[model samples]
Target chain A: MSETLTIFTYDWVPKGPRGFVRDLRLRWAAEEAGLAYEIGAVPFEDRQPSHFAHQPFGQVPFLTEGDISIFESGACLLHLAKKSEILMPRTPRGEAETTEWVIAALNSIEMVSVPWWFLGLSGDHENGLSGWLDSRLAHVETVLGGREWLVEGRFTVADLLMADVLRIPQVRARGDRPASEAYIRRALARPAFEKARADQMAHFAAADAKRGEG
Target chain B: MSETLTIFTYDWVPKGPRGFVRDLRLRWAAEEAGLAYEIGAVPFEDRQPSHFAHQPFGQVPFLTEGDISIFESGACLLHLAKKSEILMPRTPRGEAETTEWVIAALNSIEMVSVPWWFLGLSGDHENGLSGWLDSRLAHVETVLGGREWLVEGRFTVADLLMADVLRIPQVRARGDRPASEAYIRRALARPAFEKARADQMAHFAAADAKRGEG
Candidate 1:
């Protein structure tokens, strides 16, 4: 905890993904945990060897604290979760449930929603993955119907990650899941999420002004 | 470590997914760690409320050790990884690398590969996910070309999961990633992996005999 936490993200991105970048996950987690952090930037137009050295996939939202660098937003969030009980309960069962739901958000839910969103870019409303995505969302709706948060009865990193994945505009609009929608609204209304999102938008806007594209 | 470990999976699955069922991930990790464990089965034909209680998605491969139960193959592997250094190094950096790569396999690689394979099931060889899947495979090929294992230059659960994701017949045949293919071959050649696969297949076969469907 002595080392400074740095979250790295692209220097700039288009408006379409301005507020939805994965780095926002790390930002949101830090905000929720009250962890002080700094931001680092990598070129969006030209991914460098240095970037790949930290994140092999050349994706952003890698975290470096002292000498430890971790990539993948989920991994980064888990790393942060370990540093604070506010993000995750310290009990074995509580930690296990939080971790299970975190992986579910990434592997089970986003696994379908992201691809379905990608395929939808082809202007096909009813793509091959549409039904699968709907089924997954329905399953999520069922779970959300019974709980206020994903892991414990209170907010945890699991809820943060799941709400992030579920709040994507395309995924939200795809189905009629009232419980899931309410869950998203509740999660997004958090001050931490609002600050994280606003900060991300402002970060990109500053870059846009520098490039004379603002 | 004193609690008895049990890996839960469906009592039966169709021939198509008999070998590939995710319980193999936990079984393989247990074998690698030389952990004594038992297999628990849920009804595959009729997923009970009990199954949903353990795995909200009603998916197989949930795990129980004593009083704690966790779902998601990635989460189960992680829970096991925490107990044995053989599955994951104890050093901070090593553990971080192992975890980052494990999530990469689950979130980065399998995130796309599973859906791509699912889409390919409709007799469409050139599905919309073809290009995206190829790009992901190529990135993995590049990483594998330079390393013997996914983390710490040695075998870890990360390699176990990544190799499982890549070895899917449809995904492997889709592109020529020599390094990834070699990585899969080396991983699958391990004694633990072989035993895990054979045991899972036999478990399903025993169930088939009970139903007179063998």
Candidate 2:
């Protein structure tokens, strides 16, 4: 229990990705579970070999605790979910349902939305992935319409991850699903999410100030 | 222990997707783990309310075991992993590493390869996602060049899924990564993968005969 849980992310990033850095996923999970943790930083401008040693893709938000190291936000979230029942239910059926939704958010939703967002960056809003992304969003909207929480009828890491994936500004603006909109509002309104978002913003703001002073 | 693990897939499919359906993932895992399981099928053409009840998206390859029902191939793989160490490592560090690579395959590699392939189907072989997909594949190629296996110096479910994702003919033909090619060949060389693929093909072929009879 004395071992520290460290969420690793870039030391600083620009304005665009401030609150949305994936480390927020880890921070939010920790906050929800009341797990003591700290933020560790890798240089945003110059990723070190040690950084890639942790995350093969040079992506942010890898995690290390004790002797265990893990990357991929979805994987890291599952790792944290193992530590606390607050993040996941202990029953086999509950765990299975939770895991399915977690993967659905990562493999199903983010898989399309992230690339679609990237293609749209070229100023072509209705790119090749537009129709596919809409279909995925519609499916999720229907699911969210009927469920207050993703699994076990309560807040779990699945909801945390799903809400994060759906809340991306571009993705949120792409369609008007009242249920999904209300779901995002409900999830973001959580005290744990608020604290995680504030902490991430402050972390970046501090980096900005240091760069200015330099 | 008496619970039967059933992998639910579409009863039939066109030749185009015969060997590539995601249910092969579960079948392959079951074969690898030597777990006793059965295949259950839903009508491919007339997806019923029951099918959607299991898979909100009406996708094939949902799984049910006793009282637990789970969907998402990645989720089913993890569920199977929990039932047998042969599918995953038992140690904490080893398990963490395996899980990270599993998510990497699903969220990182397939996420790009699948959408890229979808867009390419439109005849625009070089689409907006081309550069990004290339960047991802190149990074993976570099990683594969340095290691024979993704985790624990042995074939784990991570390798099974990664190899499955990489072995798509289009993805393999898209680039010249000798290491990735070797890795894919090595994984598919396993009897478990071979049997799973053959069984999937046979299942669809029987469905074809029944359709002809009707």
lDDT by residue for model 2 (A86-147), tens: 99999999999999999999888988998899888878779889999999999999999898
Q: Report the alpha-carbon TM-score of model 1 versus the true structure.
A: 0.98
Regions of candidate 1 where Cα sits further than 4 Å from its true position: none
Chain B TM-scores, listed for every candidate in order, come to 0.98, 0.97
- As a whole number from 0 to 100, the lDDT of residue A175 in candidate 2 is 69
The C-alpha TM-scores of every prediction are 0.98, 0.97
User: Mind giving the per-residue lDDT tens digits that candidate 1 earns over A1-214?
Assistant: 6489999999999999988999999999999999999999999999999999998888998999988999999999899999999999999999999999999999989999999989989788698888888888888999999999987799999999999999999889986899999999999999999999999999999999999998
Candidate 1 residue A139 C-alpha distance from true site, Å? 1.1
Model 1 agreement with the true structure over B43-141: per-residue lDDT tens digits:
988999999999988897998987799999999999999999999999888888888999999998999999988888988868888888888888889
Candidate 2 error regions (>4 Å): none
* Shift in Å, residue A54, candidate 2: 0.5
Question: Interface Cα RMSD for candidate 1?
Answer: 0.7
